[model samples]
Target: MSTKQENIKQLIEEYMKVNQMGPGDRLPSETALSQSFRVSRTTLRGAIRQLESEGKLLVKHGSGTFATCPLPSIPSSLDRLYSIGDMIRSAGLREDEQLESIQRISVCPPDIAEQMRFSENEPMIALERTRTANGEAVAHSINWMPEKLAGPILEGDSFSGSLFQSLEFKAGVRIVGAYSELTVPNYDDAHMTRLLKDPQATVLLLKQLHYDEMNRQVLYSLDYVRSDIFRFWVRRTR
Candidate 1:
């Protein structure tokens, strides 16, 4: 979170604490709080807007802001197993996955097998998802599922949630580990023009192979996450 947002959040928490506000308690007027804190109304409003979005506060017309119900606890994000939802949730943004295609068809390109480690021309479920953060399209993903085991799942909108999550909860395939390789590629002019806002922004690509608990190969994925929206680092301790 940005420092400004963090400071505003802290102020709200303190207000809630000192006032002993409980659920359904009406918060002070925005003007009152902004004046009391000697901050611009815009900053105070930004804090409240985020709080409202996160379910901490609710605004009323001609009335006053009040606390609504709190959200149920959700598990913290972790490594080893990951999902699109986990990525967005941990980043303090909402997640939505819109399917582009899901169908079992003959491989148009035989080289997919070399990437997926399957025999040439084997059937596979090709699924594409346009990932959104804060409801804005941020990434594009493609994954291949082995055909025979995938059954009906390969043909339709089975993407009610994360593919990895659904694989475990529905298909009994537990994802134990995976490896990823990153590359900076020449931007796809057509795709980047629409997505990156800046034509010169580069694209970050990750090609990954996922394995099951039984150590069997299950999936191969290609993720195109925009470089600007993501910042990554590695830490090595001496």
Candidate 2:
């Protein structure tokens, strides 16, 4: 969270505390809160989302936001990497379906090439897909990989399972680890909004760079996760 978000969160909490708010109590309107805190609606919404993710606020669509008792969340440890399918399964929801598009690009995007350590002219494969659990879309992902490494699998018709598994089996490379960063995207994407089936949805953006056992960057992915459906946490020690 950014400093402004943190400050807004603190202010909201204090407002609830000072008002003797409890479960089932409704908070002030968005306009009211924004004016009271002197922050933009976007910033206010972000803070509300942060609080909602922590089980401190309940946002009932078409209704007002309300105070709520802490609710159980699907806990994901930050120490390990899990495929989107695996994460859905672990949440006890059936990994129902995926809609995908794949293409071979002659030139890689500069930023992606830089991250994956590819030469400017190196070809790559791009995969974009939306993953659903129990009939509800939970994540949208775009992945890029060196063509030399993933071309074989892309050429085959049996590429219906996890990308991680496909790379290990067909591509013959084991992805041992990944570096991931999480953030709340500040802008709304029309395509993503439609895919997730919610125009006002709060989304968490996760960027990951996966490496093989040889420590060579093999894949880079951008995953947009629905905050209402998933939550992740990291342990910190002093």
Candidate 3:
């Protein structure tokens, strides 16, 4: 989380504490909180949603959000794997997908080829997109898959939703699992800074190798996530 977001979260917690808000107490209106904190509505909403994710708040549609009594045990986001669309919805925001580019290529980049275990110069399909949550850009993803899996995708009318879902629906290739590494990305990178439009924002760079049901590495992806709007977690078990 960014410093601004953390500060907002802390501020809210203090308000709850000072007000002696019991479990099931209603929070102040969004406008009120935004004005009180002198933050934009967007940032305030993000902080509220983060609290809800932590089981500190309960949002009831058609009803006001409430403080949870005894705060429910927030499930680990790591426990149940999710697609990008799922992640947005879980954060209580609407998801919008923008397809930037899609094409077939004969020459694979050396790094990508190594990850996919493909021979260099082999043909493949590239899918590029930007995902927004509630109209705020949240992630940019570029994916590479073998040409054989591209048939059904190419014949489709729209590729605007989940690429993993489309690949499964069209080609019968399911993304059963993935091995992912997360790191803080260089915001100074010219292209990424321009695309995301936040040169100083902290972001998560997720490099993942998606596997099929048979445990074959069938897809490779690079995803850049805006940390303020999205949070990724891991669960450790004995």
Top candidate, metric lDDT: 2
**Candidates' lDDT values, in order?**
0.69, 0.82, 0.75
Model 1's TM-score against the true structure: 0.61
**Which digits, one per residue and each the tens of the lDDT, describe model 2 over residues 51-162?**
8766688889789999976523455777889988888888787785564778778988899989988897999888888887777677888889988988877755224678
The order by descending TM-score is 2, 3, 1
Superposed model 3: Cα runs more than 4 Å off = 1-76, 156-158, 194-199
Each model's RMSD to truth, in Å? 8.2, 7.2, 8.5
Candidate 3, residues 31-139, lDDT tens digits: the string is 8998999998888877777777555777786687788643111122654557777777766677898887787888888999999999987798888888877675677
Q: On residues 1-238, what C-alpha lDDT tens digit does candidate 1 reach at each position?
A: 4677669878987888888888789988888988887777888877777676555777777998887554333332223345546756777777787887787766624666776677866777878788877666667788888777566344355655677767877688888887767676454534333345333345667677888988888888877766555544545569
TM-score of each: 0.61, 0.68, 0.66
Off by over 4 Å in 1: 1-81, 152-158, 189-194
lDDT rank order: 2, 3, 1
Better of 1 and 3 by TM-score: 3
Residue 192, candidate 3: how far off, in angstroms? 2.9
